[model samples]
Target: MKKLNISVIALAISLVFSTGVMAQGMSKKDYKADKEKIATEYKSAKAGCASLSGNANDICVAEAKGKEKVANAELEASYKPTRKTHYQARVAKAEADYTVANERCDDLAGNAKDVCVKEAKAAKTTAKADAKAQMKTSDANATANEKSTAARSEAKTEAADARKDAATDKLNAGYAVAKEKCDTLAGTAKDNCLNQAKRDFGK
Candidate 1:
């Protein structure tokens, strides 16, 4: 159990590093090379497992396959650079750990082995749930950010429109006052004053 726990922790750490290539923007050539490397590593690991026997060999083989699965998932995640891809990587790690843990259970017997298998399954379930929750939270945060930016843009537009309205209202009021003053003038002078108000206020 202790060894399994350590393996789980180590897997988590390795997975975190495995996807670092995503930030670098991996190309098709690099991705292909990485896949080939992973396959070679898997073959080597399997060959190493041949030295073991019975349940031990089974456990070793399971671990080798699990690591390969995780490597592929991580490589895909790195190439895609999407939330769903990263979540897939996390799921892969969970499945890999669970497989290794399940195979190890073969070494035990009766209720103890059953318990171990159950614990492994539970661990896998929890990992998947956590990954899902993280993905949802990231999606929610992205939505919130978009909404916040939209709200700010709308506020700016509204403020600009309000300023234009205020300016128009002020000009209209000034024109009215100018026209009332023109009422005191007579004939041509009155006409000229109203013309000036009209021109000044753009009426």
Candidate 2:
């Protein structure tokens, strides 16, 4: 599922980059029709979840809603084809996955469920961090292109900083997940787990 989501994101980003100013090719009428189509699909998808119950129903509903949001975000990115819109699309995907994952984690109990939720959150944080870094890099590069050689150097530095920050955020999120998992243990075992996590994540 993660691989599939990554593929979808890759495809969306590719499409977004390939069609610079895609709105120029799409008529307002066409965009409106596409939007309506997306809405109709979402409604149908949500209705399909009615047959399910309990956690199954919850998961189904969350998946339906997530898909709808991701579709809308992707559509908006395609229509506008800007870095910000692309970033928003990526965020929508991350949030959608996080929502579905959290719903799925409902099947677990106690510390296991906590760990699942934390892992899901960590995944979302990582995705968002990467998306933010990409957007910042793109913005900086664009600015550099419009300015002097010094601006190019500055953009490079900014890009590196963005990546470094993203890495830090991802590491911290992973550490949180690891720490939550340690709650399943006790005494020295839990302590050892936490210490290992700290060491692994360079706390």
Candidate 3:
């Protein structure tokens, strides 16, 4: 009787351990699958943007593709999944702002084009600000907990935002100058000139 009782106890313990291992394995597999799906979606979104044409279309497509890239990168990031989630949400909001600004650009001409570019610039600025805010929050949390890895991640995020902001500022400034020149022209020539400027400036 004693032997049988001991055998049963050993079998139960083995079963429980096996179940736990299987559960962990499943969780990892699920995470891997989710990451792949996000990447696939991002690729498809970018490809869809390629179909658009014209200045507004160009802006729309570029903004769409940019967001897609950001989304894919966030998915590939090594930080905790929760942090990735927060970053993606902020990126999405920024992308939405870009879309709205692009649409507003459609009605604009000359100085109005400059204004539209400024609107897009403002959207980008806000996005960078949001990213910085998130980084600060992450930094504070990491510092409080003394997590070197999290602090490093936050620093990297902030650096990326800074670089992006700098590039965008340069582009917008150039666009403003070009749009001013376009404003000096008149009629269809001005429209064509503005379109060319938008294309050349990658606006």
Candidate 4:
């Protein structure tokens, strides 16, 4: 009787441990499935955006494609068990910065518009700096050579800055259009319209 009781207790403990392990395995599987689903949705959105016409449509498509890339990267980052948390945190920060920069650009006019555009560019620059810093830290932690890491960081920063400048130019053009439209407005309406344009253009 004593032997039988001991055997039963051992079996129960084994079953409990096995169940916990299986649950953990299932959780990981579920995470992968969710990531794949998100990537699929992003791909579909990218394809749909590509079908539109005109400069506005082209910009819209490009933005959608960029977003898709980000989504896919995030999904890939998730599967990297060792660095998943860190990469995700970095992505979140970068996204937040981009959003704030875009909103800032949306609010400005004339010289103020140019200044706002510059501010937005600066915001993007900061985000790129943070990303490069993070990359350098990662490379350092992985025992990469200092020269190689520095070179890569510099290249990345330069590219990001160039892109920011291009975006600033586009914002300046948009502000010009808004200014032209403001000429037709009158008195308080004109002032208000211009103010709103400045706010939108990041003046």
Q: Which candidate is the best by TM-score?
A: 2
Q: Write the per-residue lDDT of candidate 4 for residues 1-76, one digit (tens) a residue.
A: 0111112211211111112222222366755665566566656766776666654455455455445445445444
Off by over 4 Å in 3: 1-28, 46-52, 56-60, 73-79, 82-107, 141-203
Candidate 1: tens digits of C-alpha lDDT, residues 1-203: 32333244234423422343444478899888788878887898899999899989998898788888888888888788788988898899988887877877777665556545656665676677667666655665555557887765665555555455545555655565567557667999999999998999898
| Per-prediction TM-score | 0.64, 0.88, 0.42, 0.36
The parts of candidate 4 lying over 4 Å away from their true place are: 1-32, 39-67, 81-100, 103-107, 144-203
Span of 10 residues, lowest total lDDT, candidate 4 = 9-18
Which tens-of-lDDT digit does each residue in 61-158 have in candidate 3?
55555554444444333233455555664565556555545554665665555655555655555565656556555655656456577676776666
Candidate numbers, best lDDT first, in rank order? 2, 1, 3, 4
Give the lDDT of residue 150 in candidate 2. 100
Superior candidate under TM-score, 2 versus 3: 2
lDDT of each: 0.70, 0.79, 0.54, 0.50
Best candidate according to lDDT: 2
For candidate 3, report its TM-score.
0.42
